[model samples]
Target: MTGEYLAGRGAYILGLITKRIWFRASLFSVAAILTALVAGWVAPFIPYELSLTVGGKAVDNILTILASSMLAVTTFALSASVGAYGSATSTVTPRATQLLVDDRFTQNALSTFVGTFLFSIVGIIALTTGLYGPEGRVVLFFATIVIVAVIAITLLRWIQHLSSFGRVRDTIERVETVARRAMQAWAEAPHLGAQPPVAIPTGLLSVYPADTGYVAHIDVAGLARIAERYGLTVHIAELPGAFVYPERPLAHVSEAVDDKARMAIKNTFSILPDRRFDQDPRFGLIVLSEIASRALSPAVNDPGTAIRVLGAGHRTLADFVDTKRGAKACIHLRVHAPALTIDDMFNDFFRPIARDGASVVEVQLRLCATLSSLAAHAPDIFGKIARRHADAAKMRADDALSFEGDRAALHMSDF
Candidate 1:
């Protein structure tokens, strides 16, 4: 399989798993129970016998308290998490909620809490059933102490995480981070290591998707293998982030193929309900723009957030361009995929901000400055696009700002 194909598949699976709370929690809970069971089984084999001052009743009382308190904590945590998710969805863009849902610290903290609670419950039941002898009780007591320590640390961190979990600023940072990774991946393998076809071959047979959805991933390796096996040249019409329907062609084969080969080609394309950032950097850019647009809305009127997002977008794009210099070459494939264009990137990320933040002087000025900086560092085409955006933003500023001085300050000459 091609590296891009494997990376896409891995990202798809990891994305699905990390977004769900139960998967990590269940794994932790099982580990907790298993650890307790294993400790109990080995307790009697200890070589040293010691006089333990702690009594069974005392241990029982401690376990009882832990179990009850943990139940309360878990319930509270669940409620708080729900509220955070709801608040994030209502206040910020709903697209950002996915990042909050998949937060590692929050997931780890909750899973740790739930697992420790299960550990205590299992330990208590084992102690009460006479399954553990005196030595086993001693082991369980020590284990309980360790569990308490763990719970204390987790609780402290969870408190810290909750402080900014669903806040707009935190959500934006999370989105930026995901966007950066996606951009870097795209920069490294612009065409999934396949050379772009010179042009669409004449008389190519078109292959369409069976259903309508966003193109989540493309199995380039599999496509290449199929092309090589069938002695055909395949041209991918849709990139990973493109939405495809029954009427749209997914790919174009140089020659007509049997139903089985057509089905094989179709299977290489993964269609999902929503676009993901890992394979589709454009989705990330779109999300960042959405946040900026939301911030610029009359209801929110948060220009600072919009400005910060602009800076973030600038940095991400700059890095994407800078990294291209050192990007590793990919193995050639029989299939060819189209490269993402700078114009599309700008449209996805900056156009909305420019349109929505037209009235805000600070936002307009920042956009011009950012675009100018990008233009300075980018190729001729990038510079041209940047100038286009800067000029458009200035027009909006002139119309929106009442003061001539304000409009003059935002003049294109400054950029």
Candidate 2:
């Protein structure tokens, strides 16, 4: 209710200003026209019988000439007002200015037209009703000029208030920077399965330096739930913690430690394959985390369990490499053991590429599946997945596989 009242007040104020300007311009035009009509048509016919007394002296001829000159002056003033309005409108209308004050050219033109028409009607009545005396014409002409001046001053003040050159320049610069970053992110992001680009805001979070490196904290559970609920087949790196960017890649973290932790996490009994696991359906990650290391201990580990654990770890590592940006990458570990698991997983995941020729088709398929899964359930996460896939595809083509200029190239588009 308060908001509505304020809005109403604002609108009323605007209307009042508009009406004032319009009436002023109209009256000025009318005054000018009246002067012209009186000098050109009425004054010449002023009968000698209607001689006016000026300064207590009979000065009929002098009075007539003076009145005619005033009329001419008023006419020129009115014409000038109209011309000013036209010029102002032209200057302000082309660019859609951020400041409303600069838009007054159009407003002034509208007001002038209405004001002029009203003035004409009033002047015509005043003249026809025998109210056409030298005194009356002079008074009306001066009043009209005053009105036009007042309105012009008000409009000029408004323009000055609306446009701050410094502010506008700053806003433009910021907008340009944001746009550039967005474009670059899109270009660099992965897009497996030829999926659309992810719409992540660049400045959504601030980067903070941690003990190891810079960390970017973000919640991924929301995305995970969305993906699961929607039955998406996309690959999502659901790290509730912040992503760490270290100075060196795989330099601070030990590959052996990571491998050991990952193996342990995998040995832990997986909730995914358990009957009681799906009861809550939310313990998927928890279950995996618990069984990873416990069930895969070197003393009593099953080969099958180990393979699944290794595979899952590899998938997570792939996702990290594909999506991560900048020079350094960091892993956050609220659960200390998982940090080692991640390192080991990453090492093992990439180690195979050195000896064997990496299968482009396999990688592409994995990327497609990951992106598709993400889109189906968690479109937001899916967008991220799709972005990483696209980036991976590009990397594979550029550095890993030499399929340049090959129309029959293996790309997400081909799938």
Candidate 3:
């Protein structure tokens, strides 16, 4: 039980760290400082013959130049990043801004630039203070060269990244990638290592959340352990990514638990102001749909982008259904969780597109084709869900499309 709690806590902390750009930048900055310090300390132990005949003034000049240039570079990069974020929020879905902010390539490039700047500043201070001997200057000079190389590489990569940073296509791809990963994880463990949820027994006590927010993550392992300790069967009422209010029950325990146990169970759920895609596959799907809907809006009227997003959504659902084949259920948990249905996933991704793109014959035809493909490949339950959406989309197309030929062309053979 303790292990489960710690594991859950660790994962949450890691998620928090990854989400913040500064955490990684701070780590790299510290590493840069330590590298300089260690190299200076070790310099004297090396033989004088191996030391380069670099002058103090020369090393000082290089360090000064690096320090000043890096400062400007850091500022420019920060401004560019801010611009990218703002553009993304305004042009793309605002929810996608978080992903852009947390992007690994962009963050790493910025961190490298900032870390190099700090390294040079420290080296300059140490040099001016006469903290390093002749041998130390050699180490500092070599380190300076390496840092310059790193800075150049990072600058080049940052330039390339800027080209598409926060663009709609890039944001959609990022969201799709994240959503696909989440779907893979869920498909692998759809019940979250618990039996399929059943009706709460008549005597079981319902536990409500003290605060209201989206249920970001559920510590299923912790919940299972808590259920085991209390000799109770627990049924979760809310899934990760679900929004909860004070009145809604979070879970039901087979027997009444005391205040302490109730608190522990509540702790198993992590509530936050917004949903994340790492744990919530549905959130990713919704984000993709948002991007498509934005493109299909009258102001944008970009049916091509909407069509591309439909393909992405179709591919994601296809992968999800394919992964579920021959999958085994988790048998070891004491807590039960509700399973997400194909109908829900279909609605989450395609409903908005169907509504927003009703007037665009191209988008409507593409949506119906995607749905037909999914229906053909999906199992019986999922095929029905896909056909239902196809029919609904066709009805919407018939009502909104100006010409009967366009509406007739939107029909799916399977539907």
User: lDDT of each structure?
Assistant: 0.81, 0.34, 0.81
Off by over 4 Å in 2: 1-104, 132-134, 147-415
All candidates in order of TM-score, best leading: 3, 1, 2
C-alpha TM-scores of all predictions:
0.93, 0.21, 0.94
lDDT of 1 by residue, 87-195 (tens): 8888878888888888877788788878878988997888778887776777777778888888898899889888998998988898998888777777776676666
> Between 2 and 3, whose lDDT is larger?
3
- lDDT, residue 352, candidate 2: 28
Poorly placed runs, candidate 1 (over 4 Å): 1-11, 51-54, 325-328, 379-381
Per-residue alpha-carbon lDDT of candidate 3 for residues 10-93, written as tens digits (9 for 90 to 100): 587677776699899999999999877776798878668656446556577877888888888889998998998998787779
Q: Mind giving the per-residue lDDT tens digits that candidate 2 earns over 245-283? A: 323221111122344333332222111112211111112
Error of 2 at 312 (Å): 42
| Deviation from truth (RMSD, Å), model 3 | 2.7
Ten-residue stretch with the least lDDT total in model 2: 273-282
